[model samples]
Target chain A: MAAADKVDPIHQFQIHPIIPLHIGGYDVSFTNSSLFMVATIVLASAFLYMSTASRALIPGRLQSVSEMAYEFVGNMLRDAAGKQGMQFFPLVFSLFMFVLVANLIGLFPYFFTVTSHIIVTFTLAILVIGTVVVYGFAKHGFGFLKLFVPHGVPGYLLPLVVAIEIISFVSRPVSLSVRLFANMLAGHITLKVFSGFVVSLSAFGAVGIAGSVLPLAMAVALSALELLVAFLQAYVFAVLTCMYLNDALHPSH
Target chain B: MFVTSAYAQEAAPAAAEGDTHAGTAVPAAEHEAFPPFDAKTFPSQILWLVITFGLFYLFLKRVVMPRLGGIIDVRNDRITQDLDHAARLKGEADAAVAAYEQELAEAKVNANKIGQQANDAAKAQAEGTRKKLEAELEKKLGEAEASIASIKAKAMKEVGTIAEDTTSAIVEALVGGKTDKSEIAAAVKSASR
Candidate 1:
């Protein structure tokens, strides 16, 4: 491959298993995705625990940040899912914090993009999708299938509408997984490509050095955009999860 | 009618599409090499789920829930205090209204009592003046009757004396040698009107 066509340094997402234990002919590999997932969980827990340890009338920075996060997730749940949907607050809040921490950690110089991994994203998506399905059944029993039934429609068009509803329902996992995975993969790739340009171009001369400034600037700008996107993707995921939960809670028109 | 053809129509295309993908160049070994589901991690997934669930349940049921409950209780107490304050103010307003009405009723009764007393005193004074005028008129009428009876009595005595003296003078002239004049005077006085 040409040096110009080489994969950038940032494209090098390192993967390592935490516990290198082989058990009974099966490789139960704990990959970097698992490491980051565990780290994200721990970091989130500690931050929240420390922030709320001292409940004060007047909160300092840490407390305020934690409270803001709580209020943000709480308000989002209220807006997307309504007051009746508040029962799912703990699950949704944890998911949001986990994703947020995972995405932010990925922005570090050497870290794995857990959200970029299909297994990780798919796992989370499947969990949400499964929960929605189970909840729908628990809430409405077999009658939950009537969510596909369009009220006051012509009999002839009813079958067609029901088919569309089924397809859309099945597409939930696809859309959810793809949305988070694609965003993370694309952001990391762009950052990698720009950083490579900054390094390779700086070797030429003073003019190359000046030309390198452009890519560096672009990289910086992209990093900021990615950080914003990291927060946004988590928010979107949580919001959609809440929406699916709503469909389960109230299946009627 | 719709079901017979509809199910057939859907299944026909799905079967054909499946065959087409099966004919593709992807190696089957790679697909089989990595098991779609790993049994080893299955236990871990279940374990993690139970652990997270249990931990969260404890936190919520024990710690978080209690703190949240305290916050909610404080909020409720604040609201109840406000409502009690409002109720007390309402009671005060009602009492004020009742007191004003009672005072008005008492004032009306007092005004009526004063009016009745003024009327009673006027009636009594007029009655006293009427009785005093009637008694004065009766006393003047009694004095006038007594004066008239005394003047008539005096005039009758003077007329009797004048008649007796004139008769005595006439008899004395007729009988020139009347020696017993005193007896003639006594008989004329007894027969006088």
Candidate 2:
């Protein structure tokens, strides 16, 4: 009791059901995580909707922002997957906006971090890989497996190379999901721990308050770094999706 | 494999300490899965994710994409049209300038022609006036000379008569006799000659 209580960084990720409802015996109860997810959708959609609703020939500030988001995602997809990737623009845009807005919304105080969960990130990763798989097979048939075959490997080592390629291909979803999830997870945890250091240190009196400045500054710096990570992870996810779609489009080597 | 076990190890100590800020809120039962990894919540999260994300995707596809893509397309089209218009205007302005310069040069040539004609006319009129004045002066000089010559002839005739008469009178007086008029006349004429 003489010291400040221990800070619980994991507590931030706890999900509390806001509206407990059952749908077809499934626990589809609306939770805080779901609330944030809905919020992400609303915010992203509203921003895109209202900002561009004016559709000014000369875009205003908000319109420019919305346009930039569109162009950013559009360029990323086209660059990674070429013109054919334009077909997947909506999917890629939705995923990018969802992840980005969710990450940013999570950054606010006491807001739920929806993407911090393994399921959500995994589901998103699966959606991308799923699209790539379905489209690959649908478009290329069994030839889609050619992605596992490199063009220049010696015949004797072909088996080894293809095995490696297959493993690498399969690992894409796991890495993709983990990358976004872990980045958001670790960054938030670090930010909280550093902030907790400031809180716990400042509890010890004047000297403690003075000593807490270091951790406070560190937390602030980590926050800026987290903001960068949020945007970067979303970009990584979208770009990777484009590349995967590219592999599907041109399954040779 | 890695995440679950690591989370277990890290969260075990925190759960045992029972010093959690919101007690029993997250780690409800001893067997409750970690909230992030909890299977029970997966269905709900996935369901809601499917529902909300589906809605989000539809919204972006139906509403957001068309509007955003349209605005961008419009702006680009507007920019291209504006540039084309500007180029056209520039071309028109250049044509107008060329025309203005052409008219200016033509006007300069016309003014020079007019000035040359006027200079030639003034020169011709001045020459005619000078020639007319010279002719009048020559005629007046000729008339004055003719009149002077007539007066000189008349004066010379008068002088001859006066000398003859005087000589005749003198001769009569000296001789003291009245001579024949013809003979006196003949002698006087010879003496005067």
lDDT of 2 by residue, B82-159 (tens): 999999999999999999999999999999999999999999999999889888888887888887888788876675
Mark the 10 consecutive residues where model 1 chain B has the least summed lDDT: B29-38
Provide the lowest-lDDT 10-residue window in model 1 chain A.
A1-10
State the lDDT at B67 in candidate 2. 86
- In model 1, what are the clashing residue pairs, if there are any? none
Highest TM-score scorer: 2
Candidate 2, residues A41-88, lDDT tens digits: the string is: 999988888888777888899999988989999999899888998999
**Where is the poorest 10-residue window by lDDT in model 2 chain B?**
B18-27
Categorize the docking of model 1: incorrect
The collision pairs in model 2 are none
**Model 2, docking class:** acceptable
